[model samples]
Target chain A: MTDLTLTPVQTRQSHIGKAVLRWSLYILLGVFALFYLMPLFVMVTTSLKSLEEIRTGDLVALPREVTFEAWRTAWSSACTGIQCEGVRPFFWNSVLIAIPAVTLSTLLGAMNGYVIAQWRFRGANLIFSLMLFGCFIPFQVVLLPMARLLGMMGIAGTIPGLIFVHVIYGLGFTTLFFRNYYVSIPAELTKAAKVDGAGFFRIFWSIFLPLSLPIIVVTVIWQFTQIWNDFLFGVSFSQAGTQPVTVALNNIVNSTTGVKEYNVDMAAAIIAALPTLLVYVVAGKYFIRGLTAGSVKG
Target chain B: MTKWLEEHTPKLVLAPSFVAIMIFVYGFIAWTAWVSFTRSRLLPKYEIEGLIQYERLMASPRWETALNNLFVFGALFIIIAMVLGLLLAILLDQNIRTEGAIRTIYLYPMALSMIVTGTAWKWILNPGLGLEAMIRGWGFESFTFDWLVNPDMAIYTVVIAAIWQSSGFVMALFLAGLRSVDQEIIRAAQVDGIPTWRVYTAIIIPSMAPIFLSAFIVLSHLAIKSFDLVIALTGGGPGYATDLPATYMYAMAFSRGDIGQAASSAMIMMMVVFAIVVPYLYSELRSKDD
Candidate 1:
């Protein structure tokens, strides 16, 4: 009976059927890919079209007269609030906020992770646990108090204030990322460094830091994308002149006073999105690795 | 002194972040909880009252809509993303030639911010300018896809945009989980005259429970904190038809001068997060103990 099941006459027919099924699967995947890429295609084509062409054209049509005018306007001339200087200043604001936030948070997290993973002092687990909870809590829970704190610090509505918030909130994930990576390193490495009379800072600098390239890449990309893409903190903490690119993008697109410049809106959206998109396209493998690692550990 | 320093260096390194989190995370949570019970408005007041803000929050029809929308959006977003993501993962697991390209395409959305996703989707969903117009131009004059403007359907538009952004992420997670499943067991099952589908259903998928749980936790957390997406896409508009608690809290505190309302809403959001995360943490820590 088992032999009959294995050598059934249906095998020949099923082979062809499986081929058809496989092709259908490919087709289905192609359709889904189209769905995923459609908005991007629309954005690109729409951004390329002039206002007149956009009005006359369908969303899916390739631009009849491609122009960089929208791009120019989005970058240099578009009004985001009262400022007609376009998304430039806001773009720089985001850069300012993200660079420092990413650097400080990653450094702090590395130190925390090293201590928790290697040094293992008293109450270390408790500290790690408490920090990890920060990763999961809704930011609303802290927004009011954080606003009050930022105001009290007299840094409210400043880029530095936004950076502080990002760093504080970011500590949890960065710590988790580094701690997980460091946990896999053998304790003997640290012990050897200690035997050679290396202090904590020395061992970390010489032994651990060099070995952390992979995790650091993961950590940097994660932090860069996160802080770059952050909107809530950007909107809440910073106002007009200091607002990040995200807040500017929101303002530019959602502003209701003027003619609805869909083309400029699309272009500005692309500009706001370009950095992280570039990161993903360039280092997608690292991004995926970081994502999976973060999810799995959680 | 050297020995003491050696013993204490780790603690010293950890102390700053420890203190910051204590004040920033736990401390703020406590303060927000305290603020929720007061009658503060416009600015935070320290006068302690009892449940007036909560009572007002529960009374507001907008809050009711926001809570209901949260449940509806959360449930649909989680379920739809999981199903779609799993299906994509299973398809890609067939070892197709285009796996790398397709996976990259799917995962790219996750890299963009909610603002970008919301903006792009807004353009595509705009009634006269987007899908509706395109379909209408394609000789389907009666066809309409105006969920963007319809108040009753606006929240679903948020759901659609969110699933578009996140399903790819969930797919990557599931694909990773699917790849790590032992193949020998599947081959054994196949050799025993079991069908391929049966092997996957009965053996492979059962082992992926932990991934599903993780995905659920991640998606739920995202749903609760869904502020930026709503802001960019709908602005919780058409008369507050799509106010998720995050947006509600923002509107209350920043725009409406209702600090107490914001605090209460924020506390409710935290409670929702705790409801989901606390049990998951308990299980995780207990499992580690085992």
Candidate 2:
């Protein structure tokens, strides 16, 4: 058949056709890349522009002259409903909330995951299943009750209250991450460590903990993103001083202040988004690994 | 004493998390379920009434809009995101050299908070100096992309922003799925003179069924839980025209002090989730047994 061997001109023509097709694919992908990147580009450029320029110039144009005035105002002096303090205080609030919550959940999850994966204890599978189910419930179902519970614990409207809520809600995902990661590890390691007369904590400490660095990084990054970007809990469970950056950013953008400063709003948004974006850029593979592991397992 | 400690220590380590889940997650769900049946108003009422709040919720016009919008939004979001994601994945799988950088760009939006996504889109769709203005500046004076301000068209804007945020995620899932298919099978098909399109449509796509389900579950779950994006983009505004159930529940409980309505709406949301998730979980666990 003609397909058995191509003539020279035919080969040349087919190569040309293939090159055209490949270029078209790249062009299509590049177009979509622009679609996805456009908003971020606009956000950055608009944040750097003067208000006058934003009003007069094209939405996607490069700024005529970059200015940091809006960034300064958004960070330190913009009004977010009765409080002239910008999102700076609330930005720190998110940091404070994310750090402890990530640490506590990851540690607890490691221990829980280790026990469930290693021991095969009684009722272990059922408890793990129930915890896994807990991950999928709409947070609205738990919002009212969590608010009341936090109030009863005397930590309502406080950073600790928000932290407690996150760590509790975050338990299901963190544990799932650790448990799945631990399951791949052979059981003989634990059995050998037990033969060394090491107790539960000792075996976990010397063997599993050393090997848990990957999962720990994954869990910490996952928890930090969830807690940092949280808006519902931050809005519902927090008061003025304790609200996280997300709630504050919402207030600032939606706040009916003197003038509608689009530049300031964009800057505040970029600020609120910076830390998680940094994590995503630096450790994206782990981020994707966490996402697939966490979502698909459920 | 030492023997008892040795035997019970693992359970001891897990006890706190176990108890916390039991109390905070399950126990709180029970509490919310109980409140949904009551006449709770400004504050929660302990005495349970019979279906009154659910009755009110069903009868309310806004709740009707919310349910209708959820149906519309959920269907479109899942379908479009899957199709677009699949296309992007196929294109990216062409053995292109810029795959890593392009993948990063596509997924970077996912790293952003929905609030940020909303903020960015809100400005872009501002009707005056946003997309409309830009197009007008480009000599298309009659052009209008004012979906943000038009009550009937506002929910679609939310869908657009949501797709922008999530489709890349679906692409990542599909790319991984596409890569996992056995290359030898594809090669054999190619050698059999099957067209590239035929090989994909008949062999590759169908084999990625599990990933399709996973993507569906994730997208639908996200659609149901979507609150921040709606709040930030439109504030469920133009007369509550874009109210999802989550935003409706928030308005009722926190804004309007109608806890009963909030509780009922929350219950309905859980039911919707349970309908989707229970079967998925059942299959997941059953397969695990094999």
Candidate 3:
């Protein structure tokens, strides 16, 4: 309609107008990109600068003299508390905690989701509804009871205790991801497997699990991010030696007695952030799938 | 035994997770709810006394502040994140050349933990050495970005970092929703000489009601459970001025030795979540039934 109504000169003017609009859109998008990148920029720049330079120089300026001292300290020697061991132990602590928790939760959730979606027992829907509602409750509600229970179970303030808590809370989400995915898979495949006398684990292992590669990736990424980035459980359930990197990072930055080592704090923050950042950058498609597919923790 | 096992295998596999959830999710909620009614302080007292803890919670000024902050923070965080996220999504949808890089930048913050976000913003909002000092360095002597230290404006700073952290994900959500809108409808509307803005308002946005609701649920959920950010950024201070309920409960339970207060606050928080989540779940389940 615009082409039909416009003369030759009018079309050329409209072309220029559209060009301006398009460029302005790009500029607006670029500005937002800058806003989003600002903190990461500040962290990187501040981390690379010396303390003397950080104090005397601009907050967001590129470091005139770049140094890895802050990174070294943050990784190996920054004082998180009375302990000056840095976030290294806590970083390894997170790795240990996240792996078993992620694996166990993904496997358990896959089984639970498989049954609910395909096997459809007499009361499976009821069971699922019970479990599904569990996902949205704020962890604060569960913290006190879980603390006492962990103490009773004699795993309180330990790494295994943290893993146990994550696996338990993570079930609802893991089950959900698998259930929805398996539900999309045609029921006939499972029926044929069952008809051929393939048992429960057999059918799952040979048939469903083979088709489950994509969902497994999604579930693994989702649980890894949630468990890795977890602060509430990490802070509450673990003792000094068992603390995760996020808690350690918090302590390093917020410990009030020292001269505030802004560079070290930024480095520590980045170190804590690097794992999930890598996941988002490398396999962002699956990460986004997990995010949208009811990994409801924010 | 093997034949019997085959019949029960699905239930057998589910039994462990089911029992754990029952114990942790439902059972612990019951335990916490019981504690809220007890006189437990500094430890667990299993005896149910009444609603004394709730009365105490309602009467306390700090709890009042926490509740008020939740209202303010929840509202602003949801509204602004949604608006800004939708704006970003719409802009990114316009056949932009570098959309992936921009989307990745926007969504990367969600990958980082709240503690990281808070740590960065904590420095950026620092009064003496942060954005303020940098701006002052540019020859303006009167710039003050002291919300990190100011009592009244502290909660808003958390809101800022939170919006930065979450709105990108919301953009991703809305962008997905925008892309899923029927292209044919949009094409037809454009052929009718309707403006792009009109097409969005009249057709595209209106079709995103479900995504809008889901985003609201997600953000409000984030707001209610916000603890790490507050702790890292403000530590619920300048005298607990920025205390959200989650932080308030933590203070009462672990730091202040008021387990009863923690329990009661926890119960209230659960109630708030249930209030929001149950209906959302109900509607979602109902729709899935179709």
Fnat for each model: 0.89, 0.75, 0.85
Where is the poorest 10-residue window by lDDT in model 3 chain A?
Answer: A289-298
lDDT score at residue A191, model 3, on the 0-100 scale:
91
**DockQ per model, Cα:** 0.88, 0.86, 0.82
- In Å, residue A255's CA in model 3 sits off its true spot by 0.8
* Candidate with maximal TM-score: 2
Error of 1 at B13 (Å): 0.6
The runs of at least 3 residues in candidate 1 whose Cα sits more than 4 Å from the true structure, single-residue gaps closed, are: A1-12
**Structural similarity to truth (TM-score) of each candidate:** 0.98, 0.99, 0.98
Cα lDDT, model 2, residue A108: 90
Scored against the true structure, residue B157 in model 3 reaches a CA lDDT of 97
DockQ of 2: 0.86
Worst-scoring 10-residue span by lDDT in model 3 chain B: B281-290
Best by lDDT: 2
Worst 10 residues of 2 chain A by lDDT: A289-298
Query: If the candidates were sorted by their DockQ against the true structure, best first, what order would they fall in?
Result: 1, 2, 3
lDDT of 1 by residue, A123-209 (tens): 888888899888888999899899988999999999899999999999999999999889899999999989998999999999999
Here, model 2's chain A TM-score works out at: 0.98
